[model samples]
Target: MNKTINQKAWFFVVPVFVLVAFNAVIPLMTVVNYSFQETFGNNVFMWEGTRWFKQILQSERFHAALGRQFLFTGIILVIQIPLGIAIALSMPKEGPWVSVCLVLMSMPLLIPWNVVGAMWNIFALPEIGFLGHTLNGLGFDYNFTQQIGDAWFTTILMDVWHWTSLVVLLSYAGLMSIQPAYYQAAEIDGASRWSVFRYIELPKMKKVLTIAILLRFMDSFMIYTEPFVLTGGGPGNATAFLSIDLVKMALGQFDLGPAAAMSLIYFFIVLLVCWVFYNLMMKNEEQS
Candidate 1:
């Protein structure tokens, strides 16, 4: 006799669905509505299908922001993934120190994004701040507020400090899940450290690393708050990623139509790129 599944479980899910609809679906519909129309004061709206989309697609500012966004994501992935993996590899698989190491690695991830930015902003000041004063004393003119390069460096460093812990934690989790039997087998085969990592550890860690990379990419690409707080999208828009640019368009310029259109397009671009990365990762997993 087959057991009947509970139909009442749908009732349990309904509240979550309604919440999602209220929070996500409603705002999304509002954006779509704004995207296809032009508006003036007094609630006047004119139908302008795809006009905003086309305008945004052709805008140099949007393209520049997109390019910068990609570059930031790329740089972060390059640094964080390798560094996290190295750290994970070095971390004790099991010992009294394991908890200590894990907690230390995770400490940075606990800070709120805006507060991290504020902390860094103060820390990196070129005069009164310790970092800035030390750099200045060392004969380095470090002024993030004025120099575009300095601003970019500060933003990148802040992001790395804030988010690298995520990669490390994920990588560590993956490392922990790996069975001791594999290491034992590798030892029986007299495998070197490189060989063990290459043939066993790396393959085992692939799934988690993919997750880490994807998460880092998406977070870095969509990053707004920390950089905005630190640089305010200055020194002259040098650190203006796509999210910052979109905010400027939507709120600063009050161009709701184009902002909405750009938001949809940006959403899709993120989705598409993430899909490609996911597929590539799966293919690698299959191959290994």
Candidate 2:
């Protein structure tokens, strides 16, 4: 017997394919095109080959920005992951308070990114803002605008405030999915709280924790807007992570070739890290 395949479902996918091509593929191709050539006005271009890429890879500024980006992402991950899990553990799992807790947690994630940046910008001014004023009143010497330490602190604090909720939500969902039988078993065995968490909750949460780590890594690695608005990459480029630096090169300095090269590098870095995370998570799943 010969089978004829029905291809009608592809019609539904055609629109989505075309939309992605127009929005993602086409612009990506343009960036690749610009990455190889130098332009000097009136559509004039020179085929510079790998010159831009070499410059970007060798630049000290790029290195500095990359290091800062890694540092920021690392710090936030260390803080947010455990903190989110702790808060989720503390939260009422099944009560009227659950709804109130969830809503409160969601509020930060609902705020627009740019608005969060702008809000934090004023909120950290060290003059009129409540946080700034309170800190200064307590003799903390906090001034984000002109102080590198303060700027970094403020930016990190703002990020933790805005994003910890996401991790909390994910973790709480993971915890709730776990069967109560595990807890009952632990109770019967006279398991300590830490023992329950270690042998049962943590193991069960591994998958979601992996997902949470990946999401947070991607977001923090590509973070740009909030720190930009708050510190403006100031205090001698202290908070100028890779994204901020790339914008400065592309728009601020109008160095298209180098900027494109740097952007492609940035893209590859993010892609590579995500790929590694995926592989590690998959390997762990296989082993378990």
Candidate 3:
């Protein structure tokens, strides 16, 4: 006997497809058009071929910004993932405090990004800001606005403060999903905490951890508003990640072609990293 598949679901999905194409595809095509052409005034555009792409690819400023962007993302992932897991591990598995802890963990994620940046900016000022005042009072020369090291430190610290909660929540959910039978079996076998985690919890949490890493990587890689509001890509271009540099090229200097090309390259880099990392993760899962 042959089975028939219903095609009526297409009627419900067409609107969503059209909406997505309008919102996503049209803008992307606009960017592609802008990337290959130059506009001086009005809506006029002249064909420039691949000159903008080559110029952006060869530019030292682009290289520096790209390096900084990667470095920031690397540092964020390194710190946030382990730290989030540790926090999740230490939390009470069953208690009234669970709700409280979850609420606290979620608070940071709820704050507006620009507000978080401004809050940190004011909070870290050396004169009246509590953090800076305390550090300076402790005999430390800490001025993020004036010093490169301090600026980078503050940027990294701010991101960790803001996004680590996402990792913690994801890890905690993974931990919560492990069956009690696994722990009982581990206990019967005299499995140490490390052994239990290694054999059971770690493996169980692999999917969530993969999700957490990918999310953090993409967010950190594309970060702009917070750091731009916080440091304004300042301390002499030290914190000027790719997003900030792209904005500078497009709006600050009115270089639309190069900016559009850079944006596409930026999009490709994110896509490539996510693709490679996700494939490697899936490959490991399949092997195990």
Candidate 4:
């Protein structure tokens, strides 16, 4: 006899569906509506088709912002992934210190993003800031506010400080999930640390690492508040990522149509990249 499925669970899911519709779907639909329409003022809208999309796509400013966004994400991924793995590996597997280490690692992640930016901004100022004063005292011109290179450096450093902990935590969790049998076998085979990690730990951690990478990629790509607080897209648009540009267009310039179009494009690019990453990761897992 076939077992009957419980239909009562459907009621529980309805609330979640409604919540998602209100939070994500509704906002997305609004953006989509704005993207394809033009408004002069006072809630008046006229169908503009794909005019805004084409304009945003063709604009050199959008292109530059997109390039910078990609570059920033790439740099963070490169720095954080390896650094996190190394830190996780070095931590104690079983000890009183494990709790201490974990808490320390989590401290940065607990701070508000805007606060992190503001703190870093103050900490890196050329005159009164500790970092800036020390660097300048050492005869180096370290002014993030006025210098493009210094601004990029400070932003990257701040992100690494704030987010690398997340990678470390994920990597540690992945490491913790490994069965003792695997280590036993590796030890019995006289396997080196590199060999053990390469053959065992790394493969096991792939799933979590994929998650870590995706989270970091999305966060870094969509980053706004911190960079906005710190740089204000200053030194002449040097640090202005897509999100900042979109905000500037929508609010600063009051160009809602183009901004909405750009936001939709931005949303899709993130979605597409994430889809590709998930596919590639799953494919690798299947092959392995």
List where candidate 2 sits over 4 angstroms from the true fold: 1-4, 284-288
259 in model 1: Cα distance from truth in Å? 0.2
Pairs clashing in candidate 4? Answer: none
- Leading candidate by TM-score: 2
Q: Give the local distance difference test score of model 4.
A: 0.95
Candidate 3 residue-wise lDDT, 117-198, digit = tens: 9999999998999999999999999999999999999999999999999999999999999999999999999999999878
Scored by Cα lDDT, where does model 3 land?
0.94
Clashing pairs for model 2 are none
Mind giving the per-residue lDDT tens digits that candidate 1 earns over 1-288? 999998998999999999999999999999999999988657788899999999999999999999999898888889889988988888888789999998998889988889999999999999888887898899988999999888888888888888888988998898888888999999999999999999988888888888888889888988999998898899888989999999999999888899999999999998998899889888977886
> Of 1 and 2, which scores higher on lDDT?
2
List CA RMSD, all candidates.
Answer: 1.8, 1.5, 1.9, 1.9
**1-288: candidate 2 lDDT, tens digit per residue:** 997899998999999999999999998998898899999758888899999999999999999999999999999999999999999999998979999999999999999998999999888779999899999999999999998889989999999999999999999999999999999999999999999999999988888899999999999999988988888898889999999999999998888999999999999998999899999899879977
What is the lDDT, from 0 to 100, of the residue 163 in candidate 4? 99
The 10-residue segment of model 1 with minimum total lDDT is 37-46
Tens-place lDDT digits, model 4, residues 94-115: 9899999999999999999999
